[model samples]
Target: MRAIWKGAVSFGLVNVPVRLFSATENHDVQFRQVHEKDGGRIRYQRVCSIDGEEVPYSDIAKGYETSDGRMVILTDEDMKSLPSRSSKEISIEKFVPSEQIDPLLFDKSYYLEPEKSSVKPYVLLRDALEKADRMALVTVAIRTRMTLAVLRVREGVIVLQTLLWADEVRQPDFGVLDEDTHATKKELAMASSLVDSLAGDYEPDEFEDDYSEAVEALVESKIEGGEVKAPEAAPEEETEVVDLLAALQRSVDAAKAAKRGGGTKDEAEATPEKKKPAKKATKAKKKAS
Candidate 1:
């Protein structure tokens, strides 16, 4: 893949020439708006609201609304006059433990490849961060905005993940939630046990976008001249009202059974089968041969 940006990663006098490549790809099918009756491609027009006439691109200019219902027009040169740093550097500000960062703050990831001459410093930084269990908090400008990012090692390669600023996140106000109700100790304990039983290693490959898969299947069927039938939706399970203690007990039992079922299946698959040793050569078989 082509590099999205060519820049140097700078920290404490160390500048490593690196190229940034997008780590993720979008596989979603895209659709365009079209005229349904004529099957013609839809086109958008730039029109002046006041004049009710289509305007050319040259007539467009950026404007901001003021409190007095007036617009302040800004020219391209005026925007260019604003002080901004070039999007050519990944400037490291500090190092922090990766665990301290909230997963929600991360937005996107990009792979960092070192220039041939800068491989030494790249590997040095990657190894140092891996050993220290820390990630470098850096800032880099992409497009026209500067974004906070985390630089860390992933599978022996440096990866830069963009992060949202702390201020960008809204504070959670639990005051809106009903506080008069309380959970019993037994109920809480059972819930915790159920969570523990279900806990396992995170494997992204194990999950899939089921909705997208179904949509693709439908599309493929239509393309192949096969009749696509609407699938019958499963009936929703009704919620049962039961005593809190009984519900908790049932949950615990269900969790245990599920865990045992999974363990049995896993063990059966993992166990090695005993192969019957080849039968001793019979004198009659040798004579027939």
Candidate 2:
């Protein structure tokens, strides 16, 4: 795995240089938005709501909407002025019982690999944590933001799991839960017996994602049966626009050529010539002779 970040874990005077790698990934079937009729890929544009015009990326700025329907545009300089951490040190704050951390508060997880020279110190910390049955709560700066995380051992490797802030977790409030409710003894006994009968060790390998498997099978069968549509052709409007521009250009060039040659052939043929009055007198003299 590629290391996403290079940082050192600092606890007191002990600093172990390590590389951080993401420990989990998603493997779900992916899809794209497309036109159902012609299989054309769907596209979207960033449009300004007030002007109803598409906005370019360079012109975009972060805007914060106020509760009173006002917008505050923030520039890049303004964003940089905000307080953030850019340290490469994962400073250990303190160690606490691993059970104290609520599973719901956990966010992203990363695996820490020790540097070649720091292996001894890294192993010492990992072994100490395992023996104490504790997790080191630490503050790590990732992407210029500082967040709380915990360091724990998993299969002899130290894993860093980020945690959500306490305020971020919502309190569960429901009217049904507040109402007084109790299961009868007989019903409770039957439920307990049912749970006992179904209780077994959880083996992740035993579970199968039937839905994703079925989707893959369906797509493969369609391909094998030749059930597919050709990609949509380009729109004809662009070609028409190009032809119009080319015709206008040709007309301009023809006009320029005619102006340089004095006039057009049609114009010269339509012009009237000066009439000679002696033509009639010449014809009469010839007849008298």
Best by TM-score: 2
Off by over 4 Å in 2: 230-289
State residue 57's C-alpha deviation in candidate 1, in Å: 1.7
Candidate 1 local lDDT, 232-257, one digit each (tens): 45454333443566768866766676
Most accurate candidate by lDDT: 2
Each prediction's Cα RMSD? 32.4, 10.9
Candidate 1: deviation at residue 58, Å? 1.5
RMSD of 2: 10.9
**Candidate 1, which segments miss by more than 4 Å at Cα?**
66-70, 178-181, 226-289
**Per-prediction TM-score:** 0.70, 0.79
- Model 2 residue 104 distance off true place after TM-score fit, in angstroms: 0.6
